[model samples]
Target: MSEISREILSVGDLNRAIASSLEERFDTVWVSGEISNFKAYDSGHWYFSLKDEEGQIRCVMFRGRNGQVGFMPQSGDLVEVAANLGFYVPRGDIQLTVQSMRRAGMGGLYEAFLKLKAKLAKEGLFDLQNKRPIPTHPRVIGIVTSPQAAALKDVLSTLARRAPHIPIVIYPTLVQGPDAPAGIISALKAAEKENAVDVLLLVRGGGSIEDLWAFNDEQLAYTIAQSPIPIVSGVGHETDVTIADFVADLRAPTPTGAAELAAPRRDQMLQELDAIMQALLQRVGQRVEREAQTLDQLALRLNHALPDPDRMREQISGWQKRLNQAWLVRVENWKRDQGYFQSQLEMLNPQRTLERGYAVILSKEEHAMHAVRNPKELNTKNAFEVRLAEGQVEVEFAKLGLLK
Candidate 1:
């Protein structure tokens, strides 16, 4: 053969080489960053990307290892994640394989949310008493619903068509995945924190239980209740209702209805205004029309007069005296009941029982004594006490025997 050389390694040898080289290069590096774009995949693996003010790298922690770190690291959490940088050949992506994760700084907002929610729920601020009533005709409207959601679009579209002049304020939030609860809690807090909005409309499109769980969060439900502002909850589709609905002052079957409830229709309002004006005019016209007839009737009435006097007052006094005598009879019957109660009390008195000659025996432990039926439960020389009607006596002996 001509001078030839082929550098060949088995697939295992290749994988091992790649793995060892990658592990060696990245082994001791510590990265500081905030967790973002986190995703836990099926197949018992976690897939996420970590980023700092600088940049981001996709990272994964296998199920068992990721589970050891306990609480999930949410997006926006500042974290110093420890991991080995490696490449997943199947996807050909160089990713950081995370080993452990912990919260850092403002990243702890999610943790703090859980803590406060637990505390407030324990104190019951989110209780039924704190809930406010939704306005029947809300003049100024506020929205706590997610601005990015399709449900928001549906709401806006419906409002524009049904009631255009009504103003809508949007509060943007994450409506799905791990970051959802904190995002929602933040939005709700922010709406109140800013303090200018009235009659908050909390709306969301319909989805499965998992898709809708963020609104079901007890903290969110409580936030809706504890809000100084009245809330109208519109979540999921028509059939969907969450704890937020129960805790909210009003529940809309759909987000569109929530918009309808919060915004008064221009057409309907004008109609009502017109009706009120008509009603006032009709009443005024009727009164003016009846004025002449009323004057005539008044003159006729003035032409005749009558009065009733002292005899009626005497009759009333006589009835009052009879009523007072009946009340006295009731008092005498109450006194007789007291005497009957005294007799019953005398019958139940313990001294009366003692006079009957029945006696009670007790153990030295002060428990009511039976016939020592369970000899196994007793000890030799156990003390026995006798409780007589007049007094008590104590005695001890080597063994207790029958009365005979």
Candidate 2:
């Protein structure tokens, strides 16, 4: 055999050779173990030991790779890591540099789910204020899901049972696989554009987080939040919650539950209608009674205001009799006054006084002279006249005489 020429290798060279060999043998691997001695540095690097019942290996996740890990690794957490073997020359130790990690059974999809959830939550997408109120009784319930999905059947059955009269419009889309997210978003947009439905139900059957991964998409969650119509998410079983669940207006544990919440029961609505009808009837009856009572009161007032015909006639008769008596009394008093005035006139009449045997004497100037006491007072040469009641005579005063 030819003598093998050996070149001494430096520790750095040796470590590099081993690291290259390990990388070549296990460029990417899946390792399941419990985490131990985990430490996270301010630099965002993570160092831990992955231990099994048999043994444990040191691990390091650098800042870039660990940042993609949605959840922080804790000591004693059961996790699976996808990593490549690396050798440190200075320490002369072998360790794994993790590229990704997830909870054991969930796979890498779970990490993506968690990451998207945390991001949306931090941005306030999951806030209660952003959530809308589900319609109490949707006139039309819109469904966004694969037509072939069993969840669709479940929802339809539930809705029919609850609200048989409500109309339903289906906006069919893929509920799983890689194309599901885009399909879901398109369906949601289509439903909104139609503008017919009062509420939307985005539903899917129960499955692994991978099967429901489309619902966990950040864009899908945002679309649901920004939808003009209220959205009720029923993406999976009760225990499974997706990003869509947090951003939706309402969350239902199952597809059937979503249908139930979207509408009111027919029987219950009928009961309410009946109650309202009865109340309205009662109010109308009371109003009619009140109006009738008012009419009766008005009739009583009219009766009181009307005058009695018999009493009016009697009053008119009494007034006529009093008026006739007053007229007679006035006529009699006038006659009495006229008779008294006539008597006074007769007493003062000059012709009547002459008829009482009174004589009148006149002077020469044709003036009356009465009671001549001395005859000498008369002028003989003057003519004098004497008058009786019926005749007058003229004479001369021949002799003087005194008369009283």
Candidate 3:
């Protein structure tokens, strides 16, 4: 018999064959396990392992697939993955090409969130009537957020741009994790206790459902509902919503949105003020024009009724006394009318108020009109203009009180 011939395969060929065979047999599968050794590369690819007590498997999720996952994946998370069983020809290793993934036990948390939300709604805690209106111009804006969070920077920058003169007070707290709920509650309480800020802003950056779970706490929701100061919640991105968001007086899509809602734009306010001043000037001019026409008509009638000097020459002495009395009466009436108009103009002058010991507080940057009805409205760091009768004085109030 002739020698039997057999084919020998190289390492590359073997790996390729195995990879092709695995792809053909197990097209798709569902696997449940705990995630571990998770790493995300700059290329946007995610590499991790799905492991059980007995075994483990390597997984690869490319940028396109993982980008749609919504929430960020982290190690130690239990998840169910839908993927294709595949083999890596280069490493000669078996791996999973993940198509999608979801938290293994998220349904229960979502159920709890819905239940608490429904309960609160039934109790009218989320009623529109109960929601307080945010002040158009808050004297002091209070912020409850993590001091180290990027959201704080966004909020501060927005507030500075829109209304730099407004004072801000920050109550720092943890925005996530197991202790975040308590920290938030405590911060709200402290802001109320201080009674400093006119409005409260509760804000944080975007995160996964688990990362935002602190805001969904039952106690935290109740605390927000019961807060004395009106709360503006800018908890996450536009699409992300939480229990606190529903309970807040107003909901802003972003931290910057919250700032915008809390204060009016300085430029817009100035334009409105200018329009009002122009309207007043136009009305005053019209009134003066009308009054002058009436005075001219009265003078014409008086001239027509006067006796002619040449015709009354013989009785000049007799008529002189009557003319003198009539002239005196007319001159006195004109003086009284002039005095009344002058008083009216003086009353409308702002300088009159300043002369009467009242000063106007104007913001240095935005020039926002502010009345210092309460001492708390003053901030030592902010500059202000105090317009008096003689001249304006720029001053900063470090501390304010009645002098002993």
Best of the candidates, TM-score: 3
lDDT of 2 by residue, 1-404 (tens): 44476677898898899888877887688899999999999998999999999999999999999877666779999998898888877898889889999788886676777788888889999899888888787778898888788998889888878876676778888899989999999999998997989999999998766778888888898899889999999988887888899999999999988888888887787578557656865785676568657755655565577577466556555755675576567557755765675566455444566689987666544232333435565787778777778988987877658998
Question: How does model 2 score by TM-score?
Answer: 0.47
Assess each prediction's global lDDT (C-alpha) against the native. 0.69, 0.81, 0.84
- Better candidate number, 1 or 3, judged by TM-score: 3
Candidate 3, residues 1-404, lDDT tens digits: the string is 43456677899999999999999998689899999999999999999999999999999999999987877889998998899999999999999999998898766777888999999999988999999889987888999998888998999899888876676778889999999999999999999998999999999999877888998988998899899999999988987889999999999998878888997776676677557656865785676568557755655565577677444443554455575576568657756765675576456446687899988777543322344555666788888888887898889877668999
Global fold similarity of model 1 (TM-score): 0.43
RMSD of each candidate relative to the true structure? 26.2, 51.9, 12.1
Q: Sort by lDDT, best first: what order?
A: 3, 2, 1
Model 1's alpha-carbon lDDT is 0.69
Q: Candidate 2: deviation at residue 21, Å? A: 38
> What TM-score does candidate 3 get on C-alpha atoms?
0.55
In model 1, the runs with Cα more than 4 Å from the true position are: 1-130, 297-404
Candidate 3 local lDDT, residue 42: 99
Task: Quote each prediction's TM-score.
Answer: 0.43, 0.47, 0.55
Model 1 C-alpha lDDT per residue in residues 1-404, reported as the tens digit of each score:
33456667776677667867887876745677777787777777877778866788888889878776645667776676777888776555668877776555423544654565566667765576666766766545666655567888788788777766454556778887778878877888887986756778888888754577677676676666667888888988776656667668888999988888877776786678557656865785576558646755644554453233355445545755675676568557755765675566455444566568965444443222332434464555577765667887876647557896
lDDT of 1 at 177: 76
